[model samples]
Target: MALSLLTPNSLTKIPLTKLRFVPSLSPPPPPPPRAASVSFRRLSIMSSSNGIKVGAAQMTSTNDLDANFNTCSRLVQEAAAEGVKLLCFPETFSFVGMKAGESLQIAEPLDGPTMRRYCSLARDSNIWLSLGGFQEKGPDDAHLYNTHVLVDNYGNIKNIYRKIHLFDVDVPGNMTYKESDFTTAGTDIVAEDSPIGRLGLTVCYDLRFPELYQQLRFQHNAQILLVPSAFTKVTGEAHWEILLRARAIETQCYVIAAAQAGKHNEKRESYGDSLIIDPWGKILARLPDRLSTGIAIADIDLSIVDAVRTRMPISEHKRLESCQKISSLSSL
Candidate 1:
């Protein structure tokens, strides 16, 4: 199925029969009056013999490392206490610098003290964590990699996916931000099996590119797609939910988007509506307030992935020429 074919109207057309939220997990607090409200369709979920609980977090991170970790620790504990096996955090979960050179100044190796702290937190909490958009020290001194790290319940580093697409857009009327200035783009596409399901990893800007996601679903056989983003308020308001739902609908996979919300510094602000959507394009959960710091919890049932795929069979029907074109175009 072509991603372009899936639209806002398509979201309303999907047939839904059984809607279920995890019984033990409570919904997140209501968003403030000022935040834009998103009405999620609480429709049916496919029956599953077993499912894994996951949490997608939203937070406003600053240059203060300790403070950010404190918030992460608190959220990790909360998710763990609720029997969540995996908890995903947003981009710049550790520290969002106030100045331009700040991230470059503090970029760390994957095994550095900063990562060690998060790894230890995962061990202590006994929960798997998806630490999105860590500023990892790159091959050259001038650049860093916007790396995503996945830590297992045992606190071991399981997988890492550096962001392949960089945000270098000049939004009309809005400011121009060039991620490539400081961060190097990653070359490899990554996915790995987990307790939840086969996971496809991508960062913020990558969400705008559906071919990468097609490769993950068609080639990597990913059952869930993770988008950890620090999206600009301008774009997030217009495109975040629409693009996320489109991806889920097209791929027949669960999408867990942990986003940075609210104002981080004078120059940086994120559109924060952390969401977890099911394979049927139904939003399992989201924090209504786009700028609140919290986690949206949902159950990832692989059965739903199977059911959706069996019903639509897009993977089976995808044109061979289209698949070839997507492969050739995104190979770089």
Candidate 2:
């Protein structure tokens, strides 16, 4: 039936089934603001069954082990309260010493008192944790290993990654670090499973090497990449965020970077901009700058990672032989 509208001057008839309603041409209203510093999608995937809540925490660690422990404890509590299932802390989190020699004094066995306390905290809080950058005592007393550990919700040590690439660079005016002098490089690359997804572990200086991240993603099928760093003021300002985003985009996975911020001691300062970047290289949550210290929680959707890789299919297109040839040529 046709509906007819009668006006003072005229009458119009329109069939309901044939008539179309057009929307206003004005642009749609802007999205509602978020409480988190910045959320890429503004979609809260937190409570989604397949989505996991993760937090990356930045720190200003010092020579005092006790003080550092207190700082970490507080951060963990805060994250746990926010329902962050996995909490990641910065490099040298156990203790960043004043002198390189002090690392020798504090470097402990994997089962040391500090580690035991960490286990207790993770278990009691019911949160999985990225306990990054512990000074691990090496055998024969020759060198210490900078270790990154993933603790399960039960507080069990799931995986341990000793940093392979030592930062031996001499950045002019900003900082000069000789990590090789005090630390031994790790031989094996570690990629292991967690409650969230297949987690790949690397530390500070490892960020410069894209090959490590690539292998972790393609070779080991890592869905999340961990980069807990104590980045220097110079390089971090210029390279940190971009490098992290590049890795995430290249790997088609999540990049969670918990960093050391502010001055640790009289000798050193770290550029702090701890970030959580999505597979598409969007900054989901970031601390903004080096002076900030806190945990930033974001939802991790593994499906997004799958979708990106499935669509782009870059992994299938990687040329290993050609890359190796280029590497050989560069060396020669």
TM-score of 1: 0.84
- The digit string of per-residue lDDT tens for model 2 on 109-166 reads 8898988889888999999989889998976476899999888889789989999999
Let me know the TM-score candidate 2 reaches against the reference structure.
0.82
The segments of candidate 1 whose C-alpha lies over 4 angstroms from its true place after superposition are 1-49, 322-332
lDDT of 1: 0.82
Candidate 2: residue 164 lDDT (0-100): 93
Window of ten residues with lowest summed lDDT in model 2: 38-47
Q: lDDT of model 1 at residue 155?
A: 89
lDDT by residue (tens digit), candidate 1, 1-332: 11111344332232223444432134335456544432222212323336677889888899999989988998888788878899999999999999889999999999899999999999999999999999999989999999999999888999999999999999776679888999899999999899889999999999989999999999999999999999887898788888998999889899999999878778878888788888877677776555666778777878668766876799879798898999999997
Tell me each candidate's RMSD, in Å, in order. 7.1, 12.0
Cα deviation in Å at residue 287, candidate 2?
1.9
Task: Show the lowest summed lDDT stretch of 10 residues, model 1.
Answer: 38-47
Candidate with maximal lDDT:
1
